[model samples]
Structures are given as structure tokens and as C-alpha cells.
Target: MAEYDMQELTLPNEDGKRILYPRMQLYGQKDLEYIADKVSYATSFTRGDIKGLVQAITEEIAHSMSEGYSVKIEGLGVFTPSLGLRKDKERESGEEGAPRRNAASICLRDINFRVDKELLYETAGHCTLQRAQYKKCRRSSQMFAPEERLERAKEFMKKNTFMSVAEYCRLTGLLKTTAANELKAWAAQPDSGINYRGRGTHKLYVLRPANA
Candidate 1:
């Protein structure tokens, strides 16, 4: 097999216009099936129905945002219509405590998104496949046994003390579930890791040094 170099190519579009292509992203069929399964399991409706519903909801959100209104997608995040700032706010408390110009310039639509932790975790897990591929090219082994993967995961956590589980999975090529589980296990170690749970589905992990 020939090595594939990351390259940009010009390809013809549907209208016969040539467009520059950056890169290609391909999803495996099994991965798609797994996603379908997750959707089916998480929701009350059937998989096919939920898939269509998801697409429709996304289209609706796009349409709504295009009209300048924020559309909140459940378990995902908020999309808000944004407009450029007209003027900067004065940053003065009056005289001696006076500040100069406006503290913040440019205005944006007040849209906030709090992604569903479960969904985010699930999504982060799969991005590991891409990381795995990259690692395969650079390292001698494209294959990582479960135990090795677990050990590497621990080393990764030690190196990056503050990365989110999803980010860790992407960087380490470990599935989201695997990453989360490892974090829980690490936290279980006495005097080394912090408790990782809080109110109502909020998720976080912290590492603590025993000496400090």
C-alpha cells in the first residue's frame, strides 16, 4: 500500500465548478450503527424515528438562527443570533476610580450552550478512532491491547491534569466510556484524586497531589 499524504485537491462540484478540497472525513459503518444504537437506547422513540427527528430539529434550528433568533437544542447547546456591536460602553465608575474606554467592544447574540454531559461523553469516545489512526502512522504499533490502552490512559491523565474526558479520549485514542471509567478509577485512589460528582449530571474530574 502507498502512503497517503495529506493534500488539497480541486474537485468538480455538482454545478461543474471546480472547488478546492481540504481533507476527507469518513465514518465507519459500524460506528454509524453504534451511534444509531445509542440514539435508540437513550430516547423513548425508535432509532429511525429519532434519527429523522434529530435531522428535522437541526434544520429547524438552522432556520430559526438564520432569522436572527437563538435556538436551543436540548442536550447540545444554545445557538443565538449575533449582531456586531454598535458602540462601546464607557468603563468609568465616575472620577478617581474611572476607567478608560469600554471594557468590552463588539456585541453578540446572547446565546449560551450547556451540552448534555452524557451526549458529550459519548461523542468524545468515538473521536478516539481518529486519534488511533494518527498514532498508528507515527508509532510502530497501530494496535493497542486493552490493558496497554488503559495504562497509556493513566499516563495521559498524569501528563494532562486538566483535560476534559472527551478531550483526553481524542488525544489518547481511548473511547469516551473508557476515558470516563479511567478517570473514576483514578479518583478512587486514596489521597491522590478528588471526588468527581456534583449536582444533577454535572461531571468533572480533578487530580490532587498528596504532598500539597
Candidate 2:
């Protein structure tokens, strides 16, 4: 069984006609573990055994492909290495009338996959789909006013020594650039109540002391 949501989508090119469709939300590792458990219960193999089997198969597939060999699983598909030739423009360097510094090169572009359509269709023979029980998003657009955002960060720093841009994004739902700029702006002011340390991903924001 799988769950989906009926979503209303409008494309910029479309004349603003709302299109309704079911959007599939995928399950992660939990689904795979559950399947392994069920299969183990119905067969002699244990769940651990089933997991190891899957891991072994996956490793072999990857190993074969890395060795420049094509792999084909009966119920899945074929995995083939696809090559791409880079056409880097030639530019004379070093001196006038000198030879071009670089030339075209070939590299592995991607792994090509051709699915087994018959096996996929057979696997979906008894499939079931249902609408998801929607829950409100934890955060949204205009989640907080500008002053309130700064206040929120100040309050957070009271409980914690520092706040990273990633932490602020998670707490305030602001994009990385927006959070970074806000933190930088607060830290730039001489008497502002916020300060940051380090640079880029290593940066952390802390509250400026009241006495300072």
C-alpha cells in the first residue's frame, strides 16, 4: 500500500487553470526493512539474512559496474556505464603561436538503466493507493517578522552558546543565504546584540553581552 496527496498545481506558462493530481510521497528505509521482515516471516530466512542478501546483491552490482562491466538483474533492469566526451574549447596559452593548453577528453557521464517493464507491471498487480492524512506544515512563508527573527535568535542564544546558519534555517525556515546575510548584518553593527565566529559552514552566531 502507498499514500498520495491530491495537489493543486499551476504552471507559469499555463493560463492559470488549476490542475488537480495525486502526488506520490515515497517511503524510505522503513519500507525496505518492513518488506524484509515480512519476507523473512514467510520464508526460512531471517530478517537479518534478508538484509544481508540485499546488501550483497547491491555491492556486487556496484562492484561490477565500477569494473566496467554491465549488470542485469532479472526483475530489475540493466545498469550500463555511459561515457561523455568533454569538448573544452582550445585556447593558446604561455606565448604567441604556442600550442593549445588543453584538449577534448572523455569521461564517465552517467549510469544508464533500462527497466524491466514486464516485471514492474507484474509487481504492481495487487497495488493499492490511498489519500494521505495531511498535516499542517510546521513553518510557512512570513513565519516571523524581521525584528521578531532577531529577537528569536537572541532568545535562543540565552539557552545555547551559539547558533549555526543551518540551525537558524531549521528554526526559522529561512534559506541559507538569507540566514547568512541576516547573521552577518547583525554581527556587522558595533553595538548589535549578535556576533558570529568563523567563516562559511563553520560560522556560529552568539549574543553580544548587554554590558558591551
Best candidate (score: lDDT): 2
Q: Tens digits of per-residue lDDT for model 2 on 43-89?
A: 99998999999999989988998888999988788999887656663
- Model 1 scores a C-alpha lDDT of 0.54
TM-scores of the candidates are 0.29, 0.45
Q: After superposition, how far is residue 87 of candidate 2 from its true place, in Å?
A: 14
In candidate 1, position 134 carries an lDDT of 39
Tens-place lDDT digits, model 1, residues 134-202: 321222233666457545655655776554555445445555566567667766775544445452224
Cα RMSD for predicted model 2: 13.7
The lDDT per prediction is 0.54, 0.73
How many clashes (backbone N, Cα, C below 3 Å) per candidate?
2, 0
RMSD to native for every prediction?
21.8, 13.7
What is the TM-score of candidate 1?
Answer: 0.29
